[model samples]
Target: MKLKTALPYVLLLLPLAAFAAPGSQSGEIRFTGQIVNSGCAVARVGALSAAQSRQVEIKPGLKVEVDTDRNACGHQSLPISMSYEALKTSTDKGIVTITYL
Candidate 1:
């Protein structure tokens, strides 16, 4: 008896439910950007023989790129070594002195 009264309304909603979301939907979203550093703390600006390894020799004309697992700005490695966390903290505090030989 109640079904007879609700039959038309249920029939109307059946189409809406079936077509609301036909099937599963999926895809992908990706993002990209550019980061440019205007300058760095050193005697030279852009020109430096850079190596992405620590085992490489550090000569006067060479700027050994170190701790680059994070960004491209980690060059200018020295005879000294410091953990990335420490270096970041040090830099965040103030300018890190680079003694000239």
Candidate 2:
């Protein structure tokens, strides 16, 4: 009779015993990150004077020069080289391509 009465209680406590077992522990998960400034600024200059408001014609094979400023970038920024190519689309539109060297 006693065995039958205690059997139900033992079955109910089995799951609780697993969670309270020896060497059981709880810990917190930690995460860390940082934000940094990067990248340079580029400016384009056309051959036309500032006072001239007319549209300037650019030849297909002409080479355009651009100036880059790195003063705004952080000192930790590394030196890098780049190349640019010009491609003409089927619709007679111009596309500029940039490559990192």
Candidate 3:
């Protein structure tokens, strides 16, 4: 019968209908946004004397102290908090650089 012969062709063409139009197929659209961390401005209180400018090595167990001027911030009532983050470089292994914005 003609209907039997055309049934196979109809089934094959049904899948091709999905590709008939370029980018016309119904699909889910997704939108994404990211919030990047921004760096805070820090004011150092004391003048950097020549003695303080010397490069010092920070050992794992030892602690190095650097004095900063919190008065410059002017927010006396609010507690001051500091955070440091290290970002790894794509080209180097075991090497990280800090970014300040």
Best by TM-score: 2
| Candidate 3 lDDT over residue span 26-83, tens digit each | 7868679854422223323333432222122233332222322332222332123434
**Candidate 1 clashes between residue pairs 3 or more apart in a chain or in different chains:** none
User: Which structure is stronger by TM-score: 2 or 3?
Assistant: 2
Candidate 2 has an lDDT of 0.44
Give the runs in model 3 whose Cα sits over 4 Å from its true position: 24-101
Which ten residues in a row are the worst by lDDT in model 1? 38-47
Query: Which residues of candidate 2, in runs, are more than 4 Å off?
Result: 1-32, 46-78, 90-101
Candidate 3, residue 17: how far the Cα is off, in Å: 2.1
What are the per-residue Cα lDDT tens digits for candidate 2 across 29-55? Answer: 557875343334322346423332222
Residue 22 in candidate 3 has what lDDT? 66
What ranking of all candidate models by lDDT puts the best one first?
2, 1, 3
Candidate 1, residue 23: CA error in Å?
1.9
Local error of candidate 2 at residue 74 (angstroms): 6.9
What tens digits encode model 1's per-residue C-alpha lDDT throughout 1-101? 99999999999999999998657556655569754532222323343344433332234333333333223334553434322222465633333344322
- Return the TM-score for each candidate structure: 0.25, 0.26, 0.22
| Model 3 worst lDDT run, 10 consecutive residues | 50-59
Candidate order by TM-score, highest to lowest?
Answer: 2, 1, 3
Instruction: Score candidate 3 by TM-score against the native.
Output: 0.22
* Model 1 regions more than 4 Å off: 26-101
